[model samples]
Target: MNVCDYRKLSISMSYYLQLFRNNAGVGRTGTYIVLDAMLKQIQAKGVVNVFGFLLHIRNQRNFLVQTEEQYIFIHDALVEAIMSGETNLRMEQIQELKKSNSYLEQQYKNIIQFQAKDIHISAAMKQVNSIKNRGAIFPVNSYRVHLTPKPGEEGSDYINGTWLHGFRRLKDFIVTQHPMHHTVKDFWQMIWDHNVQTIVMLSSLDEINFAQFWPADDTTSIDSDSYRMRFLSKCNKSDYVTRDFIIQSTQHDYELSVKMLHYPSWPNLANANTIYDFIVDVHERASDYRNGPIVIVDR
Candidate 1:
């Protein structure tokens, strides 16, 4: 029988067998026995047909599996011969093909090396630019660090304390190094009031908690914008968050916004601290660009 017939028989056998077994005592005894026997025969035939079909499929796939390597080799040889353009029977044509192949191989290697060198140079340039920018803004004594809070927990003393202490030191250094137009508090207030693109709180490694520090009903205040107030929370192993939050926050807060910096379970926090310091330094130095969109770089 065809596959369709085999499937039909298989389904019928299963249904009849189940019904016969369940209703063995309730149904007429002789009728149940007969039906059970009929089901057994149908089941046997179905099993045989299914086995045959499986064997046929295995045989069909066997050829494809066995000859795959050979096919690949043949394809490669044909491609190489075509690329060499050595169809003619002449010995000179064969020699020319060999030379062409060598030239092509060398060209490929050169291209690869050139691309690698270009990438290395580009990376180095980025590093140099970052260093130059930071040097111009941050004083010698200013140091920055990152703080991440635990999931379901409000901002703790440890996280905020670490950040606050580090930033306070940085402000002191700046005051010592240069004559400031305003006190540190005044500087920070200016940043908060003018919507300065200075500090960025990225959602690295987890979904961050975001809330407004000021009164919720103060619509006239600049901080009324939900984007102006952002915080990050680190989650446990089973937790997850979305990238949409970052994008939406960026849109709402034209100056400072949050971002997700996905890091491996065992990550180096040193880089995060460095980035935070760089951002602060940049903003302190280039106060003119504080109104523009803040760019946060994360690895």
Candidate 2:
């Protein structure tokens, strides 16, 4: 078998640059992790099979593995290692690989290796799942958090959200995108339907591209077809602002106070310690409310 020339991996700058630019950030991180695997394959079988490797991440976050220009490339140094008949690939000792050709290599490297990803179970989670024939075993749709459909409206059940397992229950958390102007009403409907007690907002009300889903101040109130949200109080802190609201279901005879902790500039923490502290704070406040799914909104 002929040894692969690694430089053959490099394509024309115009083609490669545009691909990398389009698939920045999360795309970058996924590709490098897969590249690390590709290196090992080259050391053994002498081939790299993917142009881009990403987006198969769990939890229904996105479409799995969007690819472009399905092409296989070769690596030089690793292909030669088979001549010595050594099968184990020690990636760290590779001198040629030390040079970062792909800018995506460093993104989430430590977190990918060291982060705790296993699901945690609480007493409540077990209790909820123990209910006989809960229908969770056979989901009607793939959506994690299903919204109540508006009367006589098609596709009202659809929303850009997914349920996440938390310590409290199998579906204790709802992670969703920032609502656009059109979907803002549907957003409130889900909150009202599910009896969500706490919402964690990652973006500010004034931020670009994010619809102002809530009222700006304590004196303001926003009304929809099915619900009325009135500001109750505001607590300002260094890293976050807590806003309390009285949510009344206009259609149903029920009223509840929901608390929202908004992080205007999320993940702008000083260090890992600050990030950990922020998470702990959010969890603590969310637990202080009535038992319900905690809503986490994306920026």
Candidate 3:
């Protein structure tokens, strides 16, 4: 997650540990005395190796007590160090490290945010140029597989077999292939062998903009044309896209299109006055050579 969340967790853990230690009523000297007794007892039992003694203690209940006592001693010593102001040096060093880390994190975030904005702007400009030159804009690859309803067949089957299947498969692939899998063992070797981003899948839309995917309409049939329309509307409402439309009259039966001429990053364009402005401008420009007015409907 985020830095704020991590900081909160760290603070909570520290508070809980301190509370536990205070309730235990054990001091550094008392804990060490218990450990020393346990060590002597283990040695008297002919366990000459310290490592074996430690392991034996770890495996046995009485030994476990000694181990815990040792831990308490270390904890108490650390607290004593802090109370005596000796840990101030370490704390100062930590503060310096944290400040450096925060600066680096902010810089990294700024660079990525700038890159995201630039990518959006460049894509929008490309769409505008394509429109002006009467060239076709490349369609985004659908994460869904296409399926036509069989004669007298219900639409639900098509939805489950194609759209739902595709979506689930893609999600599963992403989770399994995500770069952070520790079991990967040789990530650098894999990276050198294959030219690909460490994380092959984009972060979930919900993670980036929860409002975009929240309030999902589960009542609607997945196979219905309106299902995808509703999904698009939610995404657009969160300002993820300028607008989205589906053309049913086309020979392809359905064509999903996103208006990229006006993006969220740049709001000064005269042609992009509103979410519907880009469509209106395109309609006006192609009026003489085109069909009827395209209906814009709410999901």
Candidate 4:
């Protein structure tokens, strides 16, 4: 099972105890008091030990304990769990300390340069290269999975990305850049042609000075001349925004559903508490579409 499903199955013990905060129909003001108290306790005596106390109390007294004070206590316990998202910060620190740079050197030096030997490649594809964030940066061919061009298009049709080979597969995932305004058409075209089911967007549209390639919002739709994209539904969580899009090919008479999980928080020290939360959510959601290729975009 994916992490989200596993957490759902074990909600009582997970980091989302807010779901149980008002299960007993407690007053909003009282709940806030309890929540504030729980936060103070967490700040004073570390979250792990405080969480242990809450677990013990929950085990001793059932979730629906009697008395308003008891109810407040249980609610406070749940609040404690919700505020203990500090684990995200801790895990990031550990990862940064142990992160490897071998792949960075290998890709930047060897694999990425496999096809760039011909400097004329970028000049050949005027529009794509001219609009790229980084000039002269192109995906290598040998390991790069070429995106299929639309009918009638000839020669190289460039959309900057490469096939990342995993231990047992020829193509594990496709790593690409955040889409530019001019390349939005090509971006959706790539997804339509490749049958990409999941797209994990790591950068915020506002930060990149770029227009979003997807539909405007849950209430609206957008078009790429050949395809019409409409927002079907959207779920806004604490760490990420999951938007469901239905894309119809005007020329082909077929429609496809796509999940675009956008993680707007780029993880600065200020919002470290929820950084990994969106990443984990995307990972779990992407796993649901394992049958098809995933397109991952970053800044």
Off by over 4 Å in 4: 1-116, 119-133, 151-156, 218-220, 224-226, 251-253, 269-273
Residue range with the least summed lDDT across 10 consecutive positions in model 3: 156-165
Q: All candidates' lDDT scores? A: 0.31, 0.59, 0.30, 0.59
lDDT of 2 by residue, 83-155 (tens): 3333233676566655655523543342244321112111113443222122223221233466787699655
Lowest-scoring 10 consecutive residues by lDDT in candidate 2?
Answer: 115-124
RMSD of 1: 26.6
Score candidate 1 by TM-score against the native.
0.18
lDDT (Cα) of model 4: 0.59
Q: Candidate 2 — which residues are off by over 4 angstroms?
A: 1-141, 205-207, 271-277
In Å, residue 80's CA in model 1 sits off its true spot by 22
Which candidate achieves the best TM-score against the true structure?
4
Model 4 agreement with the true structure over 98-183: per-residue lDDT tens digits: 46586445434543433433432444346635555455455654434455555776433667776665454446578887777776
Q: How many pairs of residues collide in each model?
A: 2, 0, 0, 0
What are the per-residue Cα lDDT tens digits for candidate 1 across 214-276? 222323222222233434343322222212111113234344432322223223355666556
Using TM-score, rank the candidates from best to worst: 4, 2, 1, 3
lDDT of 3 by residue, 1-299 (tens): 12222221111233234324544333333344444544344436733243454455545434343334345433443332222321123555765766687665764654454222232223323532232111222211122112333367432111100111123222221111111222122222222122212121112232322113112453431123222322233234222243332222223354333221223333333453454654454445334322211212110
